[model samples]
Target: MFTKSILTAAALAVALPFAANANDGQAMQAATLNVDASAFTTNELAQIAAERGDTRKAERAARIQAQKTEVPGVTNAGRDMQAAILNLDPANFTTNELAQIDAETSALAKAERIEKILDEKSGATVSTSGVKSLTVEYVHHGRDDA
Candidate 1:
């Protein structure tokens, strides 16, 4: 009907301005992230990453990351770092780029050292009074070599 067509035209008029605004937002976002992709060659980044070494890179990363990482009531970064602190693969990230990522992922810097016990038992029984510690009795049923 003509009424339906008129209502549609009115609605489109109202939405057209919003659509233009949305396009403008996208343009602004693209401009914000317009990084020069060719600043460093792949080989240059790899060499820099290697020269930085794992320890220095991790330390730098931790410092940057520390800003974003809030002080949790209890965090064991030492243990986590021990496991996670490996030389970053040069293929994925450049040494020059760790600071930004660390800044964003700061929560990882405040990890505390943790103690881990790996006990394998054959026939083990454990009893706990509460959540703190467990009284464990491990029995090993092995062959009797007399």
Candidate 2:
């Protein structure tokens, strides 16, 4: 029993540094993301936001769902967001404040979409074709213009 225990400890000691070094090499490789919000319906935007762990987007998605026609997956995203937000501290925010946050969120989503396009065009390995459609829409509609 004593010899087996010693062998196990010795094997673990030898393996630990190699495992750690292997992880270090993996850490150097970057994974790319491509986002195209224009092609994404409101529900998709909400789903992306929720998957990315943005609680505010989830909450806003629920609100949008309430105001608009139902879409299949959006309700789930909204529910996830609501459940996450339930633990947050309650504070009364003015309508203007809420609007400002919503605007910021929308802008960030747009920026991410743009960034994805630029990154992919710049030779990012992860590619999604929706970015091209979004770029065209942005060019034509000028959705983000002040």
Please write out the lDDT profile of model 2 over residues 77-124, one tens digit for every residue: 433343234221112222222222334344446445445534544585
Tens-place lDDT digits, model 1, residues 1-146: 99999999999999999987764543443333332223333333333344455676445444434533433233344423432443222222222232333343333331110111011111253322111222234566897795
Note the Cα lDDT for every prediction shown: 0.37, 0.42
Off by over 4 Å in 1: 36-146
Which regions in candidate 2 have their CA more than 4 angstroms from the true location? Answer: 31-146
Root-mean-square deviation per candidate: 19.3, 18.6
Top-scoring candidate (lDDT): 2
Pairs with steric clashes in candidate 1: 65-106, 69-106, 75-112, 76-111, 76-112, 77-111, 77-112
Clash-forming residue pairs, model 2: none
Assess every candidate by TM-score: 0.22, 0.21
Residue 114 Cα positional deviation in candidate 2, in Å, after optimal superposition:
29
Instruction: Indicate the residue-level lDDT of 137 in model 1.
Output: 48
Return the lDDT, model 2, position 83.
24
How does model 1 score by TM-score? 0.22
